[model samples]
Target: MSSLPLTRVDFDAAATRISGKVRRTPTLEAVACKSDPAPGARLLLKLENLQPTGSFKVRGATNTVMSLSDEEKARGLITASGGNHGLGVAFGASMSGCPAVIYLPESTPSSKAAKLQEWGAEVIVHGAVWDDANEAALARAEAEGLTYIHPFADPRVVAGQGTIALEMLEDNPEIDTLVVAIGGGGLIAGVATAAKLRNPDIRIIGVEPIGAPTHHAARAAGHLVTLEKIETAAGTLAPRTSAELNFGLISAHVDELVLVSDPEMKTAAEWLWTEAGVAAELSGAAALAAIRSGGAAVEAGSCVGVIVCGAGTDGIG
Candidate 1:
């Protein structure tokens, strides 16, 4: 364990390092950005769902994979993902012109596997959970001399994820609060780090699936705690463990954590589609779920930014 190298400078470097490589992502101001319209609370959406890979995962994956040396890239890349991050790694490997091998748990849906494969990755199904698959992916990386990109554990990846906050604050200097969904914690970790560094008073509220509650449990215990089982259908946001790096960042920078149920997320997703025609996955809608449910305090006319982290047809279809 190396000490986490996350800082404002690192985040700025990642922003500049992956500028045109990844979309800057647009910010949309709309009342519909909320789960339900609030009388005076304004909602702005950071539309990362519009990214090339349809998720914010690409930022970290691109920063990690592209930062690799030519020889490292030539050695190939390997990782484990349930969905979004796998697509991100595949996209990163493709950009690097390096072969990518993504390991998925047997429980992952065929549609997700197909999506990764579509990105030119060699998809391998192994074990019964993401941790099991991750172990296998690690072993393969060691045995085959492939570079392994940890979804949330790596500092570079975390720093890359923070770039979203940099862009958001730049676009809306008055954004007083940031609402983000956490899976493995990379996105929230990065965003919180950047946002807090930029403005220490900027509130960072992290949303997690009620069933998962990875960070909530960790914060309650004052250390990392792995869940015995996951009970959420939002695979992208159901990681049982939040890596030490992410835990530390969230602890230091995040103002609060909100838990949203799968049903709430689905309702929020449906609301997004109906109100703004934005197709958001359940995980992506978790932030709005917290917002409109009064999960956090929304003072009148406060400018809050919610990240639509990914795109999916889960709610509409």
Candidate 2:
């Protein structure tokens, strides 16, 4: 495998490369609420849920799809996703006029599948978890001679995801800490790389569901290790293992890895709806959940930013 090519310069270039293709999502000061981390801490929410596909996955998917050669685009795109990434791939392929086949785990919510189809993707329901679906997608890609887009493993995908950090910091240069949700680790891998390169003093904190702490377990073991099983309300974050490239990036750039419970994420989702009028899915609310539950820390008066990475579901009420 090639060494990951993620860098501050790569991220900056990706920002320019994918400009106007992906949403330059806004960053808003978090509304004061009962779930506030610290009384005087300034919390900014990077509203990635506002992306074209309702998730930050569009950044990486669009960048990767757009970078493909004419021949590769003609060969078509294939991948597996828990939800958000599939939506992104579907959208990207549609924009690029390429056929996309997305393998989704059996547990994927129907709404996500419907959205993927709405974007003209050929959706295949396979396996019980993301890893299983991913294996099926890879096999199909090989059999069909299609280009496989690994959700969080490829360098282009990571660089594309890094664009979120670029926009966040550009919008708020004083952001001293960034809290992001981790699934296969693409978003944080990219965001941490760019954010740390931009300001080494800035802290990059990663949040994962306690039931699906793929990156957390990998960090503890000091190597990638697949979970025997995963169970979480944050289905998008239930990948059994973090990609090796993503693990290495997390080790190098991420400052902290915190686990939040499904309940905590659910409460955070509710809080976002009631307090901020933002309807965040559980995965999208994971970062805020970490802060609210004290799994991730914020110092008073510090400028903290959270990536609200997706809003694929209706209000969990």
Candidate 3:
């Protein structure tokens, strides 16, 4: 809600405000960063999967909800999420003593909807896809005069998510590349902006499920594009479309876009759990999957940062 373009300065400030409010999170250094084209590459995992909400969405939702004025907070909040975002918003709103209404597609798993409801959010099941649910949520927000908490399109949300890059780079100054999962491009765009601001030389790579390649399609067309249908097991990353503003941010800051199959992501998630003891969701493991599939190569002795973005068990193993 601040402006069209989110700045690194604002991101840092949000990080400071949410410092004690959120986990500083831990970083896992991969023993073997590369074995092929990027032999000897050093890699570290930013374990956002360990956040209080079991996902990085809390960072954005917390920041946005806390920034709301008392009047706005009293008005209640409404939003649409694939899964993780809804939980984050619900938790944040509850913390702020603000009621929340979450609109989710009927396709969303009952387990996820139950989690949101547990946080005191009134869950509404409507539509068949993320976009359709989003439209309905928007309508409810206007009709009820509730505050609309956008999942990713808002500058506040982007800045909040960008704080992850700041925290990671602050601890590992040698990082040369960042690989992140992309949904509506919120996490990737924010991370790219913050990481690039700190080190313009750092390469920002985005990974999306091959079944839901919104960012990939948008990048190809140089604009936001919507998918008629998405059929990925990675529910959190199955946004039917990419936000134009987020697409622009990613296009300018991200260096490359790669995709991984659902099966590949599932394998990556299982591998991470076994090898790193990290509980990663399907979409959360996608960045690592892309790298494993030879999507991007890190230079020898260079440090690369990978975001383990979520831990929800909705659509992933």
Better of 1 and 3 by TM-score: 1
Output the better candidate (1/2) by lDDT: 2
Candidate 1 error regions (>4 Å): 1-4, 33-35
Q: Indicate the residue-level lDDT of 120 in model 2.
A: 86
* Prediction RMSDs, each to the true structure: 2.2, 1.9, 2.6
1-317: candidate 2 lDDT, tens digit per residue: 12456766787777887898888888878766465554679989999999878899999988888888999989999999998999888888998899999999998889899988888899999999999999999999999999999999988899999998888888899999999999999999999988888888899899999999898889899999999989787889899987778988889889899999988898888888888888889999999999999999888889999999998544367
lDDT of 3 at 27: 93
In model 1, how large is the Cα lDDT of residue 180?
Answer: 94
Candidates in order have lDDT scores of 0.87, 0.88, 0.84
- Per residue, candidate 3 scores C-alpha lDDT tens digits across 1-317 of 12447776789788976778779899988664333323578778999988887789989988899889999999999999887788889888888888999999877778879988888899998887788899999998989899998889987888889999998989999888999999887898889988888888888889988889998988898777888788887877888887777977887899999889988888777668766777787888888888777876666778888999998543245
Ranking by lDDT: 2, 1, 3
Clashes of 1: 1
